[model samples]
Target: MAEPTLEQLREQIDGLDEQLQGLLNKRAELAQKVADVKIATDGDAVFYRPEREAQVLRQVKARNTGPLDAETIARLFREIMSACLALEQRLKVAFLGPEGTFTQQAALKHFGHAVETISLAAIDDVFREVASGAAHYGVVPVENSTEGVINHTLDSFMESPLKICGEVDLRIHHHLMLSEHTQLDKITRIYSHQQTLAQCRKWLDTNMPRVERIAVSSNAQAARRLKDEWNAAAIAGDIAADLYDLKILHRNIEDTPDNTTRFIIIGHEEVPPSGEDKSSLLVRMKNRPGALYHVLKPFKDAGVDLTRVESRPSRSGNWSYVFFIDFEGHRDDENVQAVLAALEREALDVRLLGSYPRAVL
Candidate 1:
């Protein structure tokens, strides 16, 4: 057989591209048909399913045997599905934001760019939006690997009637950015969110010890402040930097290299069990000796793997506390049901936050 010429290779590539485009449109048409069938059966049928999406993404990854990496391929398909889902019913996602915050990035990361995002000023606002059906879902930061739990988010859950639908883990990368008006030698102050400042504490202390550190409401707010302030820099993520058009003075300034934040998706509907899922619980026990032990004993007895347990002062009584517990199993699982039954028997008050699909990407 003769070796294929460059022209022949180009022609083959062009033919494959045409086929791919046609197949993509066919998939889209099928998605439209699925939407029609759902609407015909029920007027208010839910268009998004976190469990379904998780299973598809996992299958896409497991079925891949390609030059493209798993995560890369998974992302491409996620966007494709996101587009198709939007065709059914465009989703609205609310997140903690002034427009360019980490929570917004997390929301987009989980829901994809096809959805419309509503940026709210506070985490509670995000919760309210979802609870009121103003947004299909909300994304709020629950914890940072370096900074421990976000008590605010946990406290919000104490009163809110929302369920955890999904989870997203975003690797945080903070950059020291400056406005065009400022130069490195001229910088005299640094600004960032309180948690962000703490996350990059050692880095700031070692390099800019003399500069005054000020904490703002958010990283995006800090980035926006740099626009008019000539002698200042902001420690923010790429989304904020790009939004504010700030020049990068330094990148990845977080003290810990692997610093990541976990954001939970809040919605009105409960997520079904994906093969891999995690459940959260809020339990309040009588403030007495062995109360904590009793709370933990069930998980051990049931053989359920507890992922996290954080205590917050109960709003009801003095010295009383509510524990926010996370574990590695779906509520429908037999072992998890056993644990919940044990807690219900012993605990003064208990609430299942939700069982949700764990973060896949």
Candidate 2:
């Protein structure tokens, strides 16, 4: 067989395009039917299921045999599902912000761009919005690969009744940016969130050691400050740089290249097992000779994998501490159940923060 002519190739592409359009429409129609069936059976129906979406994305990645990478293909499917769910109900997502914050980015990344994002000023405000039924979900920074953990977020969980339904790990890149008013040589000061400053500490020290560094509430807030401060630049991300119309003076200025922050999804309802899932537990041990040993021995006995463990000073007293832990299996699993039973016997108190699907994209 000879190579096909340009006209023949064009015709083939056109046919495939038509078929793809038809199939996409068919999928949308089926999704609408599913919504109708749900509404008929239950007056109040949930269109978004974290477990279901995780399973679908995992399968999409697993079954893929193509030129495109699995992440790219999974993202396309994510947007498609997001659009379909929007038809049923536009989910309101609240996140720590003034907009253009990384938390906002994480929320969009996890829920898809179809969600209506509510940018609250603080993490507590995010919890309030979701708790008050103003938003369907909330996203807040839990920890950073570089900076250990976010204490405010961990502390919030102690009082709030929200459950962690999903998690998103966002790769962070900091850029030293300035507006037209701020020239490279004339730059007098630098501004960023305290965490952002710490993240890019080494870069700033080497490049602009003499510049006055100011910490603000959030990176987006730092970028906002740049508009008024003619001689100041801000260290922020792509979203903030674009939102504030700042030029990137130096891109990826973080001290570490692999700096990433983990965010958690907060909602009122608990998520069911998503096959490959992780459960978080808030444990408080009775004051004893071997508190830490008793806390960890059960997982070893049950043959469960532990991911992370952090200690926070207990608000109840000056000397006590609470353990925030993440581990392999869901609460519903047999092994996990046995571990929980052992915990009840060993610890003063144990709270399952929630079992949720691990980050897929």
Candidate 3:
């Protein structure tokens, strides 16, 4: 048998493309039908189901066998689902932003581009927007690999009655950008958020030690400032640079190549277990010897894996302390229930923040 000629292969490729397009349209039409059924059953149905989407993505990744990686394949499917969900109901997402921030990137990453995203000035505002029903969900940075915990985000969780529905881990790449009018030789000052400044501390010290560094509200804000200034450059990500129409003087200026920031999805609804999930809890231990041990012993006994445990000064009193715990099991799991019951009996106060699927894409 002779190998197919270039013309023959091109014809076959076009045929496959046609078939794929038809199948995609069929899938979308079915999705609309599903949405109709959901609305008929429940008038206030949530079109975006974190657990369901996670499960679908996990299955796609697991079943993938192709030249493309699992993440790439899953992303293609994510956009499809996002489009279908938009037909059902467009999601309103709130993020910490004046626009073009990492949080905005994470929100788009998790929900896809179909969501209607609104920028809030602060983390607290993001939480409020979601809790007050102004937004269906909010995305906020919780921690960065290099900068420890975002204390403001942690504190916001203390009072907010929101649940962690999902999470996205974004690899941060900071670029030194300047406006078109700026003179490269006369760049005497740098601007960025305090955390961004810290993440690129070593890089700045070695490259531009004599230049003055100023901390701004956010990297986006810094990028905006560079639009009019001639002697200043902003260290920000690609989004901010593009948004501000600035030129990149240097790319990936962050000291650590693997710098990553973890952002969480906040919503009013409690998410069901997605098989592989993580639960977050807040516990206020009584001020006594072995108080911490009492709070954690249940998890140890139940063989539940604790992912994170951080202590914060309790707002109730000067000397009192509260712990934020994240573990690798859903609240609905038997072991998790045992742990929560134990904590309730032993701790001064215990609150379950949420049980959400682990990040898939």
What number of backbone clashes does candidate 1 have, counting pairs of residues 3 or more apart or in separate chains?
A: 0
Model 1: per-residue Cα lDDT over 1-361, one tens digit each: 9999999999999999999899999999999999999999989888899999999999999999989999999999999999989999999999999988999999888999999999998888999999999999999999999999999999999899898999999999999999998877988899999999999999999999999999999999999998888899999999998899998888999989999999999998878889999999999999898889999999999999989999999999999899999999999999999999999999999999999998999
Candidates' C-alpha lDDT: 0.93, 0.91, 0.92
Poorest 10 consecutive residues by lDDT, candidate 3: 152-161
lDDT of model 1 at position 349? 93
Native-referenced Cα lDDT, model 1: 0.93
Q: What is the C-alpha RMSD of each candidate to the true structure, in Å?
A: 1.5, 1.7, 1.6
CA lDDT for candidate 2: 0.91
User: Runs in model 1 with CA error above 4 Å?
Assistant: 1-9
Candidate 1: residue 326 Cα off by (Å): 0.5
TM-score of 1: 0.96
Where's the lowest-lDDT run of ten residues in candidate 1? 179-188
- Give the clashing residue pairs of candidate 3, or none: none
What digit string (tens of lDDT, one per residue) describes model 3 on residues 88-194? 88999999998989999899899999999999998989989999999999999998999888889888888888989889999999999999989989989999999
